[model samples]
Target: MNVAVKAPVSTLIQQAAGRIAPNWPLDKLIAVNPYWQMRQLSMHEVAVNLSWLGGVHVYGDVSHYQHVSDDDLAQALSALGHELTVAQFKQQPLKQPQPWQNVAQLADLERDSEREISWNDEVVHQISQFAGDYFASQPQTGAGCDDFYAAWLDTICHDHGLEILMKSKGLVEQFKALPSDATTLVEQALTMLGVTDEAQVDYLHALLLSINGWASYSAYVGWQAMLAGKQNNVVEQLLAVRLAWELVLWQQLSSSELQINWKRQLAHSNQLKGEHQAYVDGLQVWHLANEMQIQQGLHQQLRTPLPAKDNAALSLQAVFCIDTRSEVMRRALEAQSPSIQTKGFAGFFGLPIAYAVGSYQRPQLPGLLAPQLEVREASSGKLATAQYSAQWQKFAKSSAGGFSLVESTGLLYLGGLVKNTLGLGKAKVTEFGPLTLSKQGKALPLSEQADMAAGILGSMGFTDEFADTVLLLGHGSQCQNNPHEAGLDCGACGGQTGEVNVRLLCQLLNDAAVREALIERGIHIPDATTFVPGLHNTTTDEVIVLSGQVPEQIEQWLAGATEQASSERAKLSASPDAKQKARDWSQTRPEWGLANNACFIVADRKRSQHLNLGGRSFLHDYNWANDKDFALLTTILTAPMLVTNWINMQYNASVTDPLKYGAGNKTLHNVVGGNIGVFEGNGGDLRIGLPLQSVHDGQKYMHTPTRLNVYVDAPKHAIRNIIDAHDNVRWLIDNDWLYLYQLRDDGICRYHQGYWHPVQ
Candidate 1:
């Protein structure tokens, strides 16, 4: 197919490929904003583009708006300065389709009656299967093939089953004759489709969106490469593969009349802009109103003045991650005794390090940053038993002995399965001894350790006035037979438990030499003060001391807090026993896992300690007065705020459009390529985002589909300065991806486009 191309096809291909957001694998599953690449565009503009390109819903449907009370809707619209009536808005029609449809979709519409399978489904299935094999953790057949497109082509050319499934006899021959290069294939496809210059990017993007699952995974590869200061073109290759399939279908089904009609439709669609303005505008109103209603409730809670600080401190202070789940625990712990002060910070505790266990090294930091240091077990005695068990499992799964081993152990497996079913099986625990922190395989110097300690304390505003004992509690969830368990773990720890980072931080803060170095710098720790490391099991609401001796009073406080928090959590779950919920293999909603998350408050705990946020707000303790130059505030906004936005958007997207953006039914999920992602059934695109059960209860949605409302206790000018300095922060705010509020002495104010207004 030697078709002449007129547009900058390569540039368009790259531009289209860049639209796909990265999907981290199951092992390090982090919530990603699906429209992150389109942040420069306004939400309304994105709504139009996504609708036109992929029929994606950027906001809630009209039915979702019914939940909002008429009075609330009126108040919300008034707050936004919109005059649309509730009746009129409710009557608005749904978004209509654009004429620009992918060729694969057209092929499916015109599929032969005899063929039960659709071309679109077959294409997605074939590509998904090939991608699963290509991107497998352990490479299957195409180990040496570095180019994804070339590998897929090479594999498809010999696969006779695809030809039969696609019901095309010469498909293999056609694949064998296709261009070997991605760019060439893309150019040829564009030229053949007669896609105009204005429509090329949209057409290419639509093609990628058809197989968005693999494209997202490919984008993750590019994201990691970019993080390492390198370049990757796997997304572009995936786009080319998608285009090739379109080319194949077009050639087989091409007709003079059909070609003319398709060209006309493409040009017409390109020309017809704002065709769904009414629908989009109505949706925007509803979206804004919903967010406003939530914002108002949050404001009501945070409006109270902070109480006077208590100078008399005894017992201990506990610091926890700013995760929404931690709010309940922190609130409960403080309610136990007035002597205990709980603060919130990022779970990694300001340590950018990776933890090495056995032969595998996992980064124990946020996904936004790479590991700067390493921590490993100080003793190997506890690891031997774990390693031996792992080796035995590996041997049992090996091809050489798999069947025989399974046959010999079949009865034992059955017994274990029965025990698990009856909830009699005990949870497995892999213990680690003391940890040693290092940089470049060498011990970190005392000065560097002190610098890290100072940075942690300074950023978290923990300078001055130390308690007799300070507990650093990191959190992790416990769930059995869940492939998406990492999603429930600490995202700040790159989807792993916060054990290593907290324990390592404790070691640094407790070091005598490091403390001496810190004293030389300006910060001082009392000789009587001690640092303790603990793990907050989010599933069971138990705080387990990992090391050192916590005082008896502090222990009692934790026990009381656990009892209260567990009781509160039990009301939300199906079963009253939290431990059984963690062990039950069939328990779909082990814990809500940050569902209903709506607001993030960056202020003193005292501002919100009195009011219950219903476990929906991410609380970070920050005192702007303590932070000079706004550096700490900048870090909080840039890192933790952005991470929370990603989480909020992931939930929003999953709720607004569950099938396209969410992993479908959890019961139907089949783990693909050993944790790459899940397939709803045997074959389809790899499902990304939370499952339906995560966001939806059996009867109704659990997560409110509202953008995150971030309330920062900083000066408006300081917040604006940070936003002005960072393009991403500016984009997120200016484009309405999230709402930023400034906490002032008078009241909370909203920030919009370099201006602030009393949040009505």
Candidate 2:
């Protein structure tokens, strides 16, 4: 046990100090023990650090070491469940008292109050001398001490996860020595299983043949590392990192091959939560469960309460939602709405208005100019003087020629209603008000929209933003293109294709009118449709951004810049055929799909294949040339409609509310005119893997569950109305809705409140 000095022990101690000081005062211990030092440390640094934690408390004073004989020291370590190191026995420190007061004084102080003192050159000199003298009187008996140290190391290593590192190292060495052609087919299978490296091919090939070969190999290496009591390398760290997947896969094969009860193994794995190997253990359980279809029996249950309001005047609660997905908006309402009162106010179009915080809590209304009113005021001799008239002429030039005739009429009505609601007198009525709209038709500004919606909701007594916030909380990706225009619908919601067409814009505006007029007729919408515009960022050499600038300024600047940029771009151009080729390509690729569903009929070979496409690329890749073909695709891709149809088929017509699901008295196939099952797709392809893995001793595997989609085909208006009314409709209150559908098994479907909860 003649230990040779390698690197100065102080160097090793300094490194160890970083790790231990965060938890305890290691620096203070070294400061007092001037004689207890060694030099030329190696990879044994970690071991030395760990060992210090084991016995430093006993070395309180140098004389205290004299009281304990070598045997006593050995016995003390043995009592604490550790073996004395061979190096320590052969090269033991002198059992003599030195400047032990320095150590005593420091230890006596409270842990928090102990201040660290710098180790001067003089202190370093004393420690170096003591380290040499300390190891001068040991015997040359390495075997017994080695055995004791090895045993002690194993115990400590096992407690701190060092055992796994040992196992991984041994496995790597063993695999390197493995013969190349020992198991060709097994290796081929492992390669197919994702073990691609040539170096690992032989090992993996051998690994797959035995169900627990990898696990056993890893465990053996861990045991060896524990015995050696050394720090592990990179390869040795694999057990804790990927051990779970290996364990799970191994268990999966074992239970399948040997017919063993793996449930106990799965449960036991969960207890190893703090262990580095826990992930491996969990993976094993997860993989086995997937193979057994553990989630198939679990069901989702839904419940919708009846509507009840506190105030009669504001008895009906309406939610205005503007999302690209109207169906999701509808589903959200239905899932959360109560039975008695339905949420209302589902509309999208409105005149653009800017909002600014006004005096008091009430918003100020801006009035529109009516030529008739202006003439009357002039005739009544209320006209301004010559100085005012000169200023008024300038103002009139900047006012966009007052408001449109139609807008003036709408504004007059809106202003009167708002004035009456606010209890404002005519004397306070100014030329400007909140209800005024921009002469050019466009959706209201975002701030104005939020404020107006808030006002409308305020009148109903819902002063909190929670409900309105919920109405706005839908999924969307951020778009930053076209600072002035937002990309809305784009055929997604049966609306306009783009800003290029004024017809589509007019359609949207007219629809807004229809909705506003509906409210005027006392037909309040409880579920409001929300409009969300997607944004895109377009950057080109000629492009220049003037964010927050007025629209007029942008147009004026662009008018001058466009001509120059166009001329410059025209200079570096391709042949005319190249342009024609692009144009031809664009014409071949149509943007719209049949029935406004965004599905397309591409003439792949003139038979005209139809695809049920809606989102982005559905038109190009999948579309239908005929209505019948489109219906087939709809049956497969849209689950909402498919599930609805299935309910219609399985139920008796007389009992249920047919209108709720858009079903008639006829059977599902009769109503739709055909039976289709192509939408189910293969179960394996549709499965989304469960987010868990399992491992045993150190192995893992993954698991997944199958999910399906359903599609429906309906007109735009009908679909919008359906989505709007969904929140209040009680799809469950009628027993006939459930019984007729024969959906008793809380298995395939579960009824929580009012809608069908599809089990995944």
Candidate 3:
């Protein structure tokens, strides 16, 4: 339930400022108030100021807020070029303050009541006891993916608040005191208790922080109870926190009400936790087994229709394939398989084939390569089909699940992903896909692929319905060659024979191993992709094929789309050019300006029922678009919240507030392109571009809060600076940096190969 506490705009700031002062890093405070207008401000302005106020200093520089409001403070900062006149402020003189006026103040004034001190000692003791118990109950084993539980033990401990409750406060303080030391306070404490090694210590410390965040939420719940003059249910509160935490962790978005379905959550926990734990354990064991296999040199026969030696001697023609589908898959395949060969009749976007393998299977002999096959789509008056070769009858099958190398009819093969020969020298990675299994020689089970795919799908905000749609779309066995007409040519694999294997390349995106490699190598992943598919009416071509050389903004759109979808709210896709504009802001920090274009007032489809509630059109005209012909983009951001209620009808209703979560931030970057696209800057050229709603360079609270340091490496159309062309830059920004680990210049960031790492 949302506590609808409103406050005088200024009052909210004052209260939050006061309450946050003692706990916040001074540097952060200063940075947040860079404009430092002491006079009047609007409610929207207040929201912008407070959005990241909590998580900034914890991860970023904490010394940004040292000075209080003062004349000298303004002058000293003006050296950096900032205006501080009260005339810059705007107030709507809405006769009186809103009803929830002073709620933050109330919390600030009643701080003591909010801080439940009664269970402090008890909570600490219980935590310590649980920690001891957790450590003591160990070394148990189970078959089939339930053996190794050590890897995630810290996560479990932290989730239960048993890892750091006893000494979290003191540990954080000690770390603060010894800021120069590479070792954390938790490390020192554990070392004293005879535990050393950096990885283990890091793990333990992370465990503490994880628990500390939860403990803080627990305390907040208690405070809320005190404010309400009644005891709140712990189960409900904890469940809410769990659901909310999951949302921020996975979806990177929040809804208005922010309520979750408890029944669903409970069911999910019961179904997933234990099974997931077992999978992790099994993975560890599998890894160990795979190592043994590699050491012994292992191999597996590809399933064929015929017996052993029958197809052995045939001159086999192998055509290397590349799958340049998704960023992640493309990168992964490229990184995993990088062997070189000829470019055959592969389509513009499909895998690059060296040559079409001709089919001819024989008994007690290998299949012979007849001739390269030329595959073409059937159009009007074109040959629809062909017949098999008579030589293929020479091969027969074995009942023990045997395999066969069959000779296919000439030109039975289709087009694949091949690059022009000219771009080889500029390619970053040449291969992808783990053709060779891991040292453990373990293959990802098909069953596990479904689960893993689901996880990935969830990350992209695919509803059950949406996922089904995608599956159905891809169900046909016949592969189609999808061309990327967006002028995105592959430089790395642009030659007659593509140099970079796009299939392997896509998998390297955000692959743990790839990320580790990049981090170790110290290369930055360029945030770039092709387009952002909107919520509704996203073209099948747009959904699958990203045309044009990969643009940074398109990548951001992909990541943003996935993040938003996870949250279960619909978002319209920004144009490819609009995405580029957002990417441009990454070049420099943002300045305060009216961002009219950035904020879009999209009609909420979920709440269309409430609009014109009294009319027949309310029920009849439920479609988001009224049959108007305009490019449509749609996406559901934020994950579904599992909820339950005593009232069965209300139980499954989504917890949503269109005014909050559905509301778009109208900052300079967003509004500049859509509305006023002119701003006077220090440079000689007048800055005319799309404005971003909020400062894109500021800290993003996604994934534990980190500063988004966008570097304008190189822009094709050179201006003095990226921020100058506000109109052009509006459509150039990349919001998918989180998804890209490797930056490939050939307009493709293939996954599974190698990816780039973000700067810490």
Return the TM-score for each candidate structure: 0.94, 0.17, 0.18
* Cα lDDT of model 2 by residue, 1-760, tens digit: 1123333423322232212110001000000101011112221231122122211111112221222344434443443344545245435443222111111122223223334322121122222222122212212111121222122223232432222422222323322232232123223323333322322322221121111112222222232233335422111121111222232233223333222222222233223222312222222222222212322221111111223333322211222212212222222223332321122111221222222122111001111101110001112232345336535432322112122222556867456434533445253211211122322334435444344443333322233222211121111111111110111222121121111111122222224554364454433333433221211111111122211122353234333433433333233233222222222211211111111111111111111112111221111111232333243233222322222222122121111111211112111111000110000121101001000110001121111111111122223333233433443112311211111111221323333334554544
Q: Write the per-residue lDDT of candidate 1 for residues 623-661, one digit (tens) a residue.
A: 888888989999999999989988988988998877678
Clashes of 1: 0
Model 2 lDDT, full chain set: 0.23
Candidate 2 regions with alpha-carbon error over 4 angstroms? 1-164, 167-169, 174-637, 641-760
Q: After superposition, how far is residue 389 of candidate 3 from its true place, in Å?
A: 48
Q: Candidates 2 and 3: which is better by lDDT?
A: 2
Collision count for each candidate, in order: 0, 86, 183
| CA-RMSD of model 2 | 33.5
- Ranked candidates, highest TM-score first: 1, 3, 2
Best by lDDT: 1
TM value for model 2: 0.17
Local distance difference test values of all predictions, in order: 0.82, 0.23, 0.21
Candidate 1 segments whose C-alpha is farther than 4 A from its true place: 1-7, 75-84, 95-99, 113-115, 137-145, 271-273, 307-312, 389-408, 417-432
Per-residue lDDT for 1-760 in model 3, tens only?
2122233322322222222101001000001111111113431222222222211111111122112233433332343243534223111121111111111212122225444322223332333333223323431111111211222223333443322532223322321232122122222323332222322222232222222322222222333343335443321222222222222222211222222332233234334334433332222222222222321211111111222222222111111111111211112212222221111111111222121113311111000111111222123332222213212311211101112121332222111011211222232221112322111224434343333333332322222211100110010001111011010111112211122222222333334544344433433333321111111101111222211222343344434433432222112122222222212312221111111111111121122211211100100001223212211111100000000000000100001111111112222211111111111221111111111222232342111111111111122222122223332222212211111111112221212112333321
| Candidate 2 vs 3: which has more TM-score | 3
